[model samples]
Target: MFRKIRILLLLVVLLFVALGTWRSDSRLASWAYVTRVAVYPVAADDSPTTAQFIRELDAASFAAIENWLQREVKRYRQTQQASVQIRLGAEIKTLPPGLPNAPNTLDIMLWSLKLRWWAYRQEDGENIKPHIQIFVLFHDAKRHVGAALPHSIGMRKGKIGVIHAFASPEQTGQNAVIITHELLHLFGATDKYDFATLQPVYPQGYAEPERLPLLPQTLAEIMGGRIPVSRERAEIPKDLSVTRIGPTTAEEIGLLAP
Candidate 1:
């Protein structure tokens, strides 16, 4: 009788936990309030360029992201004056755990847990926890001239993002594009591009899919990651101005009614 009672109590606790998790996710997606996103700049390498770049950073440096998001939210007819807020946090000198190359399921799971634990100890510049946390790692452009930076990843489960970016003036807009892309991922957006080819899928990936000339698209869908120029080639948008949140992406991020 004692064993049966203990099992029943455990089951009840599990059920409540599950329900609480579901409700929290639902609330975030509901978009009733502004989602606060904290951005922490990190120096990827010990280069003078990267160090100076990090030091010059301030909250206003990320206004492009806030502007783009606001326009998108209003475009979708969301009543919230501010759908999302980006506050620059203090620079983190340490690098987060790097993603394992060719990681298996178990490896990825373990890395994710470790990353979350690391993020939990971080202080959001304001000392208060934000709805989402994005750690941006900036690498010296000259240092990585020949090699590409690591891929950025965002976890919807934890609402955290680890982004790799360049510390060059020219790449500022492009950096925001990547950051915004990962930011939406935290809000439940999925990549609409094909992994094998890195091309935006049919209609979901195209910003204006109904355009008469689908090729040479003027704008790139945010989730698609690039502007489809030809059946065989695509180009990256220089900035968020050339990128847009499509209907499908809007739906996924709760900007549109499902």
Candidate 2:
């Protein structure tokens, strides 16, 4: 009789433990980060078309961002064994230009950013609310010294805008990293860009100053945070630190298991 009672007790304990684990997992998956990209149309050939440049640059930028994100998703799953899904959705069509007024442009952008966030928000949770959605905007400068601009979080609440701006399309992935860097700003991460001498900048942002490192080391290192270190004005290999998204930011988005 005692032997049978012991077996029954063991079974009950096992069931309880299983239930507890399942509940914990359910809670952890309450939030998700789904990504969708939208590209502005390519400008006409040599038309001074800001639209065309933006369209091309964003394509490259999205590719770089997606590759890095996918690798991070795999690494996070292996490390945490968490079931939370981080999905990359299909790229959507860019919105048509708004009114001619500059103020209208800002409003249009803010709304567009919200819409993108909403699309992702509807994916998992019962409530359609997301902490933030990343927006990449392309802008053409009207004058000789003009440049392209990416959407900024700062413009939203001034709380901490995570927007980025790029001058041209050829620097897509590199420009995309700026968006990644600004997004990290929301999480209180400082720029690793070394600004020591000229205007009294904080030091120690560059990780691989020599501009060379193997795969795993680059990903695991701290300096590989968001932006890559430039070597003699040239971007290092994409496979380096920029390949891995920061763990700290990933955790906040619930992409990593706690």
Candidate 3:
């Protein structure tokens, strides 16, 4: 009897969250003033370098993401001077909930709900709370040596993200790219890259699709995450300067939706 009652209550809570977030999703996608983003950093691995990097972080460290969004907003001719504001939140000692190894639809949905609840509990005695909460897990590249970082994820409805990034200073530029990519996902942007090949989709993913001999494209679409340099190969963007928000991505994110 107790187990049945608990299961029923859980289902009710899930339904309530779904309905509430359905409405919140529209507002978030509308580019409203409540688009403040709070970033919380966590050391994914126990390394001295990672701890130091997190300790040294400040507003200036993420300035690239801010500058990039400001530029994109102007380029798209949005009403607000800046639709997105990135700020640091209270330090989180523990890591956010991670995804299952092979998450099915139900698993993903449950994880999303748990993630949102976890985010709410993480709020400290801050005067201003963030509308979008991004938990960045930084791994020490110097000590651990070169290894592929874990995948990052963002939720459109809940406006939360768990981003895996490197703690090395040199990787900050690329980290900004991944962070911005997940940030855009929170705002309703879809990935423009092929999951199988990890290649940027043509036309929508290409920064300049109209250019002659489109192979060796110079810039990457912000949602695409790759600069196509050959038929089967692409380059990881060095910085936000080498990335652009294509029309499709802008439209999806409500930037082009006057």
| Top-lDDT structure, candidate number | 1
Per model, state how many residue pairs clash.
Answer: 0, 7, 0
Model 3, span 1-258: residue lDDT tens: 999999999899879878878876787767655468889998898899999989999988887898888888778864664467788776688877777898899998788777888888896577787778889999988655666788899877777888988898998999999999999997788999999988999989988999898889999998988999997998999889999999999898877877
Q: lDDT, candidate 2, residue 21?
A: 43
Q: For residue 102, what is the lDDT in candidate 3?
A: 85
Worst 10 residues of 1 by lDDT: 16-25
| Residue 148 displacement (Å), model 1 | 1.5
Query: lDDT tens digits, residues 127-241, model 1?
Result: 5678788999999988876898888998877678999999988899999999999998888899999999999998999999999877889999999999999987889999999
Q: Cα lDDT of all candidates, in order?
A: 0.87, 0.41, 0.85
> How high is the lDDT of residue 107 in model 2?
86
Runs in model 1 deviating more than 4 A are: 1-24
lDDT by residue (74-107, candidate 2, tens digit) is 6666554323222222323443232234657678
Better of 2 and 3 by lDDT: 3
Candidate with better lDDT, 1 vs 3: 1
**What is the Cα-based lDDT of residue 145 in candidate 2?**
51
Candidate 2 achieves a global lDDT of 0.41
